[model samples]
Target: MTLSTQERTGPGDQAATGVVAIEATRLEKSFGNAAVLRGLDMKVRDGEVVAIFGANGAGKTTLLRILATLTRPDHGTVSIYGNDLAREAERARLSLGAVLHSPMLYGDMTVEENLKFFGRMFRVPGLSARVLEIADRMGLTPRLDQRVRELSHGYRKRAALARALLHRPRVLLLDEAETGLDEPARQVLDSVIAEHRAAGHAVVMTTHSVERGIAASDRVLVLAGGRFALDEPSSSVTLTDVTRFYIEPEPGDA
Candidate 1:
């Protein structure tokens, strides 16, 4: 059942308007002889947060990479904010912000430098002030001059997030974004997500933590065998339910 506006949680009001922000159909991918994604499909609407949970090697990262335009699907179609990824890739990317497993930062550059570089690439107006604003928001103000390689793993992740948000893209794709964050950092992350949703943006995050995933999303999906085995509103499922569904072996698993 669709939750009414009053019944909805986590900034879903704009999401209820039915504006599709990211759409993927028949996505497939493979490496060598092992097929990772098998005809997967997904849709995320503006102001919505969708969490995809899966075991390691369940193709979660691969799927996010494809959606982020970092990797191409063997055969599939992806559209972001009405821009076709294949034909309008540059335009499509203008609306996407992604934090992948790699952090996607220049290790030798300071945090501020990294943000400024990306901001320039996006042709952000008022780049200097925008860098300061995002850095402060991400708790990287104190580390602005610190080289990415000199920071701790968590701080590096924060820097990557800062870069991702610098341009205020319409869709944010996070691949295991909470993995290295501490409690305080996580709280900041939550606030950032809330602000993003409030702006009618879309967020698609992949994670292995069922509790975190469900808590941070309006919808929850379990990726297994390259397909969503379970897709339900976050409010409809419990940790136990997701855990049970997740542990069940796939059809051909011995």
Candidate 2:
């Protein structure tokens, strides 16, 4: 059963809210002759940063899409905050805010306009105030009227982040969120993620950079050749471990 609002009456999402924020079991997906995921079991608790790492075309995008409710899994059960993804799709979707590499915004619109539009889509109360809050928080107040396409990569990334945070989703799925970002852009992404983590939302991101992944994530998962391969806590694993795992696989490289 889903937790009641009474669970959140106290500070933070109250304990009455059972912890398993995101859960996937034996997930499988295939594209004709190619298989993207194979019996992968993944889980992320509330208020945590879990980063999934993978080489190019290692099914990371597929996994992110499935979890974000953007794509259907060929087989398996998934849940977000105690709500079933397949059985209660709308409920499950309401709990998630996703940012893929595409930014998922209208480039023709202004930064503030795009955020306001997304706020309206989520039916957020006080849409204008919320838009301004996000804009200010992301240092976008100066470029509020700038068209999204006219902005630099860094500002566009910030705009995308603002859109994701508009409704305060319980889970944030970031598929390659840090890709194509310069130093400053990457810093902004890191700071925004920190903000999300501090706000008690479960964040799951996919990245190619081990350093960035470890720095931003509480846990690291390596998906090799389209399977849920290596999973470990970020604090416990070092860059050496990441290098070794990538350069050389164990005896069970199946």
| Candidate 1 local Cα displacement, residue 190, angstroms | 0.9
Model 1 clashing-pair count: 0
Best by TM-score: 1
Any idea what lDDT model 1 has?
0.83
Instruction: Provide the global lDDT of candidate 2 against the true structure.
Output: 0.77
Model 2 lDDT tens row, 1-254: 11221222112242124377888888888877677777777767776788887666678888989998888988998899878899997888878889888888788999989998888878999999988888888788999999999998878877888898889888888887877777776787788778777776678998878898888887677776555556666777687666554533223332
Lowest summed lDDT across 10 adjacent residues in model 2 is found at: 1-10
Cα displacement (angstroms), candidate 2, residue 169, comes to 1.5
Which RMSD values do the candidates have, in order?
A: 3.8, 6.3
Where does candidate 2 stray beyond 4 Å? 1-18, 247-254
What lDDT would each prediction earn against the true structure? Answer: 0.83, 0.77
TM-score of each prediction? 0.91, 0.86
The clash count for each model shown is 0, 0
